[model samples]
Target: MKTIKSILGILVAALFVNTAIAGTPSAKKATTLAVDTKESKIHWLAKKVTGQHEGTIAISSGSLITSGAKVTGGSFVIDMKSIVCTDITDAEYNKKFIGHITTGDFFEVEKFPTTTFKITKVAGSNITGDLTLHGVTKSITFPAKITVAGGKTTATASIPVDRTEFNVRYGSKKFFESIGDKAIDDVFTLDVTLVAGK
Candidate 1:
């Protein structure tokens, strides 16, 4: 009788242990990686009637949340004050052009010194995010080529942004009908490359 009771107790204890283990939830395999600001790049292209201006901007800080070999989420901050005009060879012209775009007429870097983007959803190659520019936030979607390997992630995308959506209407023909040749295209393009790792 004692042997039977001992066997039953052991069986009950094993059953309880199995139940407890089964009830525990599994942890998610997700990790957050810091973006390498110096290694990442953001290139901007703005067009006018006569010609176009292209330049590069600096990213201040950012991070990417990853799961396995995929980019699950991420956010990035752009330093608006770091805008540069590379196409203009003349230093004076480049400085003046940079100054003009950073003024209240355009990006208004004095009031809105930074732009930001936060990922809201990711579906295959498309990434939808909230882009905050010049104090206005709007949802934008762009296709990115993302690769995760060797403890690092690299993502590249060309994002088209409408200047008028963010209240940047200085030389936009969409805002002023009679602006004529002086009008700049409302849509500008930003080519972004982001590199991040643990």
Candidate 2:
């Protein structure tokens, strides 16, 4: 009888532990945050045979949907018209380069004034989403470092975007075969910095 009671007590203890484990909440509910457009920045680098031009495009608005400390999903819009040339010190030349980029030859900012990225999936620090630029949308996956602390969240990612894929082929040799050394690299790099608050 004592042996049976000991066995039953152990079983009861095990069942109690299992019940407590199952009843405990995993984490808090998801929260939607508004990204600070003024604080977030996107820097772009486009390379050519002679040299390269680097600049930044501003984030107009965005939001991040996070669950506890994990970024579940989000979307952000970029102001294409905010394209600035940071490489050129000459004011006139910088203005010209900025104009050219926003013109029909490159981004066609007059027609497509905004670009966006919508996160669809996030696994660990890697995010997969749809990026829309120049009126063309494509799915892209990139690694990012995301952190949440002190009521603020920050995410940073380095993305290499191929201009030809989005039909921005002004100086690309892939489209104009006879361009020679003046050809620009099809792929460009964008260093992204995002900051948001609850």
Candidate 3:
């Protein structure tokens, strides 16, 4: 009788342990974010002999990592083929110049179709990362204001990058000639606003 009672008690305890272990919740998966391309915009300006031309760059789909309340640095890849500069005035002339930009001269889009930014650290509203452009990777830190509201996230950041650093030397001389040796500024400011839906 004693042996049977002990065995029964041990089985009950084992069953309870098994049940408790099975009921425990697992770790949540990382939240994936989608870049709102329609709401997002990228533009650049260059001085010409006459005036300045402005254009937009297109962003493709990418992912961002986030925990429950914190944003883990993620990667963003930009599409280089979608560069548009409508201020050229002449349609044919603009098309020819754009084609050249896609080649080795400007972006080298064929060899490197995408420019990637990998976030390495996040400090308050400042983000530090490595930005790869024109086959060269450089460490860059920029002020990024990140906001999370009602399960939706929005981040805005601005960074000034030198065109010469990326080997983008088009219209430098002509633009400088127009502006008295200071035509186009080497540093072009990039304003990025990214929205993500949880």
Candidate 4:
């Protein structure tokens, strides 16, 4: 009778252990969300001694990696050829201006056609990324507002980039001297809005 009671207690304890193991949940894995190219937008603002030019640029492709509601990583490819000056209305002058920028003077679109930004770290409201532009890559940190909800993520940031760091030295006063009114500001701003979904 005593042996049987001991055997029954051991079996019950084993069963309880198995049940607890089976009820434990597994760890959740990270998910990749593809960027919605149609909904995402990147606007660029460049300044010179005279005035500023605001334009829109297209994203070629990208994706964001997320774990639960937090954004982990992402990258974006900018289509250099899609640059358009929204503030310029004259067709002839617009064409000339675009040509001047796309040619050897600035950007040199013929040689380096695309730009890319890859996220390295995201902490709080700050994002650090490696920006590859004009055949050069540089790591930059900027503040951004990011939100994840309902299987989608939206991010917006106003990033200021010094064009001279990427070898775009056209009319920058940092490189050229005595060019008072013709000198362009080295820093250009990029206002980006990225939308991604699973």
Q: Quick one: best lDDT, which candidate?
A: 1
TM-score, candidate 4, is: 0.86
lDDT tens digits by residue: candidate 3, 23-123: 99887667888777776666666553456666888777655677765677777778878888867889899999798778866778988888878889988
TM-score of 2: 0.89
TM-score on alpha carbons, each prediction: 0.86, 0.89, 0.69, 0.86
Per-residue lDDT of candidate 2, residues 98-180 (tens digit)? 88888989899989999999999999889999999999999999999998888999999999999899999898888889999
RMSD of 2: 3.2
Q: Model 4: per-residue lDDT, tens digit, 1-198?
A: 999999999999999999999999886688889999999999999988899999999999999888777778999999999999999999999999999989888899889999999999999889999999999999999998888777689989999999999988999888789889999999999999999997
Overall local distance difference test of candidate 2 = 0.93
lDDT of 1: 0.94
- Show pairs that collide, candidate 2: none
Clash tally, candidates in order: 0, 0, 0, 0
Give the candidate number with the greatest TM-score.
2
Candidate 1 residues 1-198, lDDT tens each? 999999999999999999999999887688999999999999999999999999999999999998877888999999999998889999998888888999978999989999999999999999999999999999999999998778789999999999899999998877799998998999999999999998
Model 2 shows how many backbone clashes?
0
Model 1 per-residue lDDT at 187: 95
